[model samples]
Target chain A: MTTEKINNISVTTLANVYFDGKCISYGITYADGSKKSVGVILPASLTFSTGAPEIMECVGGACDYKLPGSDNWVRSEAGEKFSIPGNAKFDIRVAQGFAAYHYICHFG
Target chain B: MTTEKINNISVTTLANVYFDGKCISYGITYADGSKKSVGVILPASLTFSTGAPEIMECVGGACDYKLPGSDNWVRSEAGEKFSIPGNAKFDIRVAQGFAAYHYICHFG
Candidate 1:
């Protein structure tokens, strides 16, 4: 398929909420203002194809990440830098499990 | 919400696919076998509430993670370890942007 790299970065602020009666929250948002909020649930393994390149930040715990089409599974800690190819498809296999929060923004 | 710490760690493997003509893939999976695959599209920023405790591994780029109920915004590197409170809710704001992949597993 024909592909072109898109690099348009923008900034977005987040609001913090609680999880239990104690307090906690997690969610995802798209450039179009749509969002997906996730609660404390053990998630199954998942993967996806990239439509745009994204920068993810680790907040609470840690997670393992992998680039599709390669055996290189990169381990991300509480603070790390990583990149996903635009319009590319990849799979992630949670080897350790994660409680980390992320913010996914796009660059046009 | 009523909450309890759930640490049921299990192993899950991921398959790599392509993004462009090159081959890429990305997706998420729940313990019940439900999966959400993300393609090359800039995602909206999101957050969630924790139903279970999880460990996440970072594979590719860099991301910013924040814990719920706190002002602490932790920056995760390529290889680090962190933890999230069970049943807690948190939000992720992509500071730099990411192309990294992640694996999320659970421990019961």
Candidate 2:
């Protein structure tokens, strides 16, 4: 699989990375294509399908995830990768200057 | 028309509201279905069709909009709405700790 950069970010082989405003989730990808998740600060948990075209999750504490399709955001915590299909419908969440994360999805 | 409240917000007859981290755009809904937009703090501009269901936009800065999908956030400034269909694809942008906005979409 190959990765492409849209806004100075590298993404390929979609995976969910978790964080908690402190530590990040251990990196892992299943060969069977399932969902991977972890917890972070603010007692937040993230979950997503390791399946092609990923879907990630996050918890809200005054910040959240931001996807590619909306005007507002879903609340999120510090550490977690929210993955979704490139052409899938989704949103992004940020806490404004206190936290932010990046994501990438692949479709074939 | 009537309004519905979810997560402590009232949404009805979907409309686009603009803000600039200072003054919000004049509330208006054209009789004709079209996009309504304005600018805010970061020299940002938001444009979206004021049509049913609703899709808003926001420019990026240290902060941005946060939609209902994804784990990470796209970049955004203050005062703008990034709207999308109830089941459409999109992303949100926030700057963390500095700002955040709310959104609601009705699909009937």
**Candidates' chain A TM-scores:** 0.50, 0.31
Interface CA RMSD, all predictions: 17.3, 17.2
Worst 10 residues of 2 chain A by lDDT: A2-11
Per-residue CA lDDT of candidate 1, range A1-108, in tens? Answer: 111111121111121222111111223443454543222111234465567665544422345667867787776544454577788876543343334323232332
Top-TM-score structure, candidate number:
1
What is candidate 1's fraction of native contacts? 0.00
Highest DockQ model number: 1
Kindly list the per-residue Cα lDDT of model 2 for residues A82-108, writing each as its tens digit. 455644544333434443232222233
- Candidate 1: tens digits of C-alpha lDDT, residues B17-105: 22210112233444565433221111124465566664443332335667877888776544443567788876544442444323232
**Per-model TM-score on C-alpha atoms:** 0.31, 0.22
Looking at model 1, residue B83 earns an lDDT score of 65
Residue B1 of candidate 2: its Cα lDDT? 16
Pick the lDDT winner. 1
